[model samples]
Target: MHPLNDIFVQSAAIFLELATSEFMRYILAAAGLHLLLSTLLKPLVRRRKIRPAWPPKGQVRREILASIRSVLVFSMLSLGAVWAVKAGWTQVYREADAHGWFYFGISVLVLIVGHDTWFYWVHRLLHDKRLYQGWHHLHHRSFNPTPFTAFAFNTGEAFLHGLFTPLLILVLPVSYLALFVFSVHMIVRNTVGHCGVELFPATRGGRPLLGWLTTVTHHDLHHASPGWNYGLYFTFWDRLMKTEHPDYLKHFSAAVRAEPMKRAKPVALSIAIAASVFCAAVLSGSGRAEATETAALETISGRWVTEGYGAVVRLQPCDKAPMELCGRLDWIWDPASGSYLGMEMLSGFRLQGAEWRDGEITIPGKNQVFRSTIKVLDHNTLKVRGCALVVCRKQTWRRLESLPHIGLR
Candidate 1:
């Protein structure tokens, strides 16, 4: 046999052995957690399931199969990292002490933060319509993902996912121990995020500490909604980009309290009561029926066309508690923009003086939310203002008795 052929054979054998080991390691890590969280620990927190219904029949099975395929892809991609390491191209080191104890710890931190930033941007790019249908859509097919879905990725997506660690190794002097820790942390968090249960406890008011970490509800919403909550380990990117589902905090709070569906009843009831009171106040032409604030909030309710005729938004009570006020995108001028339709646009507005204050308004197309307030200028007009940091913008929306014809624009 030719010497080159023998070398080729030896390399192929090594690659297959490494791939098998990685595959088993991933399978065990994922499946072990799945057993603990989704099975063994499930009955203890059965009430905390993010979605009421069990995943569709065979969903977990499909996710497992896809995950296996992705693992193979990941393993194949691992060869590149192995080659880089052997060639002394990567900064990976064998001894943890080479970086000292503190730098060793810091390297782990760097890998996590860097991986998060890398994941956020790559994950967002995967959601592009062009990439989504062919690539990301495979993973998304498990709309209600399981722990197995942690590794489920399209072939291209697995390739992209696998590149992160290799690239990190090339750029940073990551110890093998740090790399191992990073890999372990990655699988554990990835599975937990996709575990279809909200495992994180909610902080008080759902705005501190645990709030910064991504909850199972956060990633579950990403599966259910497909267009929001793209973060993996933390809420930083999603919050900064304003791509977080408006109800994320509410959902997390409900999950932690094990009162997921129960919270909806009061919101629905409050909306009905508010509407009835407003109508009565208007008909009686008296302040006796409802508070002036209630009347104003009621008047703000209805479909209104955005400035420049961009879209129609319907204002109503948010499904979350306090039920102050919220808005949903009802219609858009472009049919292609229909995905933005029905998305929450405003949330948590409450009457303060003549304006509804302390509201959040999401900008169409930009996927950004800003501090907002709205006021009714007349029966037919509303003044809406939003601020990010110190920059503020205001727009007027005309009340729409009915939706304008899509062709009219």
Candidate 2:
């Protein structure tokens, strides 16, 4: 046998011992946490309880029946686990003096993760039409779910569930403790999928810190919309195969939006202040760019500058004046590549009105294009505003007095 098979043969034994040990507490905590989230988020995360193919029942008879089916399936599964043990496999841990608690925990986690990876793919396949009418559809019979609705699948569906772990043990050497942890992880993630409503944060794209952690909301959506949301834990498989529903991201967005912005007010103020200062500087006269006929107001024309180089901006009224106006910006700077990254952004604004206006400014040199608009506050100062995205921002430029007076004729 390969090193991995040997370890799994070993893991099969350890799994039974830990299952009998304090491992139950870890399982309980994971279950409790998911339950708490589901209960709390029910009202906020719920859909309209629209039963499409199936109608609602008074009591959870269907759910109970499903749970019974699941229990039967697992009872059969124990045979596989037990068989490995009877073959003199578990004797290593039973008789061996010991490696202590740390080794034990690691093994349990592997077992659980291996189980999940297996279940995710197999459960996904069992949803096919041929398989569904026979096995998977039994669970779908109760469209509107309750906690007990979990595990309410036909016996055939249960085999698909067991297929993943057995195949997993054949590939790599996973620890027994890790398997248990993974099992607990799978159980909680599993229960939440059938959870009538989702409570945990439904991450879009994935968790920012721990990318790709699935939430109960995704599974709930699947129950609500069969033929979609096949992935049990992560949306990766669903996304890759395009089995995920159309509005999946929308659901995730709502969860992300619900997050309270603790620093929103302060952040807004800081942005506003930075904008105000930059505006004051721009309008105060800095550099001047070449003249363009697009200028809305001839009076707004002048030199806009930063702390260093100056960009000359000129506006000549064009196309019958009052209605149509065009503008242009040219950046004049000491061409030194190193100056760009130096704290004082040596490359933020080069075009005068282009920096502030909500219009397009073309950079023919680099194949880059941008838009900006400017609002003059005084002869010496003005506000320039523009954006690359939906988020708009402002920067100020001061009118430079030191430059030679090159007024429009």
TM-score per candidate: 0.61, 0.46
> Candidate 2, which segments miss by more than 4 Å at Cα?
1-55, 88-116, 166-176, 202-211, 255-257, 263-409
Quote the positional error of residue 389 for candidate 2 in Å.
79
Tell me which residue pairs clash in candidate 1: none
Measured by TM-score, the strongest candidate is 1
lDDT (Cα, tens digit) per residue for candidate 1, span 206-231:
43236688878889989989889888
* Candidate 2 lDDT, 287-344, residue by residue in tens: 2222332342455554455333444333332322222234444343445432332221
Worst 10-residue stretch by lDDT in candidate 2? 341-350
lDDT of 1 at 311: 87
Model 1 RMSD, rounded to 1 decimal: 27.9
